[model samples]
Target: MKQFFRLMAALFLSLVLSLAGLAPPAAARGKAPERIPTILISIDGFRPDYISPALTPNLAAIAAKGVSGTMTPSFPTITFPNHWTLATGLRPDRHGVINGAMSDPAHPGVIFGKSSEQPWWWDGSGGPVHVEPIWVAAERAHIRSGIMFWPGSTTAIDGIRASDWQAYHADLPNHERAEVVLDWMRRPANIRPGLALLYFGDVDVNGHRHGPGSPETTAAIRDVDAAIGYLRRGLAGMHRQVNLVIVSDHGMAHTIPDHVIWLKDYVAKEDYALVSYGGILFINNVPGHEAKLAESLKKMPAFIHCWGKGELPERFHYGRNPRVPDWLCLPDPGARIMDGNPEHPNDGGDHGYDPASPDMRALFLATGPAFRSGTHLPVFDNVSIEPLLRRLIGLAPGKDRDGTVAPVEKALR
Candidate 1:
């Protein structure tokens, strides 16, 4: 009887010890959930105020279940530079793509595209960007990646796998673009894109064609919301886990026709080549005309701020990239730089502006295991995004690039 009791006690002790060993560590057990297979959806011109219960039920639902905030994109507040900054977690000066259209005086062969046929200026070769993108980081971590229409993604970087990509063509329909992404997700090899980026340009296009607050722009937002709904439903059916981050490159503002500033009127067209987006203008001079043109632009009005390339505001951090033009001009909100070409009139909405303008604030929302419920962060910069993504994918940081800013701690449960 004594021997049998001792054997039973020993067995009980072993069972207790095993159960204790199996218990998760206190920190891990208390740790908030982590999301898997993150998906970043870029709604080209999404504005945070555009989200309403009536306008975007799907996005609102996400807000109810996850976190949302205003993400400030990089300086000049243009598309390509902001998107590249978001991808690499570096400022435009570091990433090299300074504007939608870049002019390289040093290497005349390096020209940015205004049309689809032009080669991508951000071919990862220009000295603009020094860090590897999140896709490259993820791939190095052995994670698969997929991209659709993210501006700087056309030229494949080493270690990253983009199943498909397209040259910048504003002519493509948004639905068709969505269909391509949906189809790519269905492919057996792409069953779960460890990281996926989807871009929708309709809102931005319509906003530029009309105005940001126009009826046409509102309708376009609804269409984009519906498309997002479709993508969410499709992902649900896949029975795979995912983290979906919805963001915008920048916001739009209405520009009055009377508010247009035609640089050609102030400076000889032959003296300066005008490159502009929204109200921000770049003046590239023909040799000796730089000083005269800069002086001429300064006396116009307080509504516009003019600075020589080397003297640009310290906040802009703009001059390091060779693509930046010789002189930078920033107009007040509700103003724009008109194209000198009379054939193309200056009408509609636009984005490029001082990053401080509320109109320039981009949208950011995350839904997945890693995010907390119904959270809101007051504000964050776009450069903070790349670092957050790198952490989720477990990748090492690149040299010389600013590491990820503090994670949206409030956004995670």
Candidate 2:
């Protein structure tokens, strides 16, 4: 009789402790209620139009339960720069990830995309340029983060790796990506990640090869949506609510081989390094040729619009960064620049244009416990995403952060 009484007393005490959250159940120990688990997915090259019900049923379903809207990419809407901007919430001018292919005078030989092997160019310590990523804010608050294939994740934050992250892997299948995320969530609560970023390149890849409107691109978008569904099922199996945000770095636009500009006609090869991305170019002029080169490039106004370092449009928040080349150009829609005879496919699509242009707008869709169902927001800037994530995860944002939640808070419950 005494033993039975003792067992009852112990059970009561356990219940009291658990109720107070002083002692979590074995299954939930060390997990934080204040820190929500969030999965941020970036589908490269997924334009807003790519999310129609006919093409992306899964995304539409998520939109029905969450907020969906157009998201404008930062200026010079290319991959690496805009992806980094999404992570840091700062424009390329501040983060110093100037373009897909760029040279930072501060970090000699450390190119942004091609020189990933160099740590100084990527890790936060690599600065004078590498800005603080939003993940670092989560980490400072004792939250663990996991990243799979998100740009800028490979670099260390304050000399420490993202709680865990992987270098880019082209061969990792979409299903495996979903399973990996599920596995991460299944870890013991103490070691489980509170934030995760997943990336898919298929939509962008198809857009570049087959053009954004091609049936092949349609098929790719559907495949990506299927992957999203796979991730949803996996998250549900965990029996825990997870916030999901799907975004794209930039949209895609059609391009034809005939619309190309050959640069060798106007300048010597050594005089400048021509970094072209569909409609944008970062021209690093040799010391003596800044003025002449800018002038020469301007002569082709029929094909490109050249701007001096300080001449970049204010809306872009670019050009001031030292990494910005001596000259910047935005080619006309459907145009591209090359050295002699560049070797890209005859026809496909590209994105590196003015962000305000319709072709440069990316997709934004999110669903989670803290958000209102069926919310649809007016078009918002991609810079606004960082604040939304910070708020959803129970963190106070820095006053100086580049994003504003006011525009997106309408979607919050």
- Name the best candidate (by lDDT): 2
lDDT at position 99, candidate 1 = 81
Structural RMSD, model 1: 6.6
lDDT of each: 0.75, 0.79
lDDT of 2 by residue, 325-412 (tens): 8787788766876665545635788888888878888888889887788988888888888888788777787556667888888888
* CA shift of 314, model 2, Å: 1.0
Give TM-scores for every candidate, taking all chains together and pairing residue i with residue i.
0.84, 0.87
lDDT of 1 by residue, 1-413 (tens): 99999999999999999998999879768955433677788888788889998988988888777888998778888888888888888888777778887766656755676442233355445574445667767766666777877876766565344645566566676666666666666766435467778788889888888878789999999988888888778767876467678899999888767778776667777678766644688768778886777678877667888777778887777786767788888888778766655432467787888888999899999888777788888788888888777665656655566546475866764
- Mark the regions of model 2 whose C-alpha exceeds 4 Å error after superposition: 1-35, 114-130, 268-270
Residue pairs in candidate 1 whose N, alpha carbon or C atoms collide under 3 angstroms: 94-128, 95-128, 95-129, 96-128, 96-129
Task: Quote model 2's TM-score.
Answer: 0.87
Which 10 consecutive positions of candidate 2 have the poorest summed lDDT? 120-129
Instruction: List RMSD in Å for every model shown.
Output: 6.6, 5.6
